[model samples]
Target: MSNRLLTYNPETEGAEGGLLIMGAPTRAAQPQPSTELEELELGSAFLEATSTSELASVVNRILRHGALLAGKPIASQVVQHLGARLNRAGQSVRTLLAPPAGRSDTAPSEAMERITGAELEGLSDEDKEFETARAFVRFAMEAGRLAARAPSTQPPAAVATAAARVAARRHAPGLDFVQLVPGFRARRAIRRQSFA
Candidate 1:
């Protein structure tokens, strides 16, 4: 018997200097990609347009990419990604995952437990966090390749507000009502002459 799971059992007679029996190992099937996830591919335009936040959004989009990818789940995926990022930056996972004071129903209390699962129990908070962060970085980097279109180049709220204010000021002095009404000025002159 070669496999660790198998040991020599006396059920069958073993011949001296004969071939030994070994256990046949079974491999799990690999995951296949789906059409929806394939649709999210980042094109050249998207790669050039995305900022850090847009990259992060693309990562979220992956969770809903398709039936195959959706099985991975978003809450767990984000936790793992963010945790790892914090760890690599030499920050504590506690800072991100730990619940705030006097809060009974926080993200850590509710979401973390679901995402971590039983198998990951042995992992330290920092290790889990690191893994999570690494996942995020990987997703973000790959997201550019999967993006369908370039991000919008719209101006920020502040800039838009400023522009609006300038436009408002441009017309602020007021309208000329006398010139606006075609016959008002002539009517006023006739009234003035009659009164005099």
Candidate 2:
């Protein structure tokens, strides 16, 4: 009997003589254009996903079907495409299936003690890890097609804080800094009014 689960020998006449059926093979119903995890053909049919969910669904389906192409070139292309989709979805491929850094093997815990030592901090380690993991999954699901629009909000507090710093720098110094808006623009408008 042939070791392959799915045999395709044309000469193998009967089920017994030719392609002897062994075990249930994880084969798709005729290898159509892989909707998601395909041969990584950019201009191929995979690029036609109309929505984010559609793209994600396709990739997930491909993964489920064990759609692995032979050769490094094909594999690399597939990885790149997957990465791109995940990035578009605001996720990273590396962390897609990885549990949080300190998570246990079996049962996932809500214990934030190990992730972060600072109890007073509003942002917990668990929260950060969960957010990161979510982003990775979303990215993978969407087939690495990053969105063109601005992100809904900064996924990480650090990014938001950095943006705040940038805004602060762009504007003039505030009144003793606390609870005061910058006066630079206001001062300019006042000068213009005087000239008018």
lDDT of each: 0.30, 0.31
* Candidate 2 weakest lDDT stretch, 10 residues: 141-150
Give candidate 2's TM-score.
0.19
Displacement of residue 2 (Cα, Å) in model 1 is 26
- In model 2, the runs with Cα more than 4 Å from the true position are 1-121, 144-196
Off by over 4 Å in 1: 1-98, 103-119, 148-196
lDDT of 2 by residue, 1-196 (tens): 6555343343222444432111212122332333532333321222444455655555554333332221112133344433333324322222222457785733222222222222313545445444333322322322211111102232222222222222222221110122223268754653554345
Model 1 is weakest, by summed lDDT over 10 consecutive residues, at 171-180
Give the count of colliding residue pairs in each prediction: 14, 11
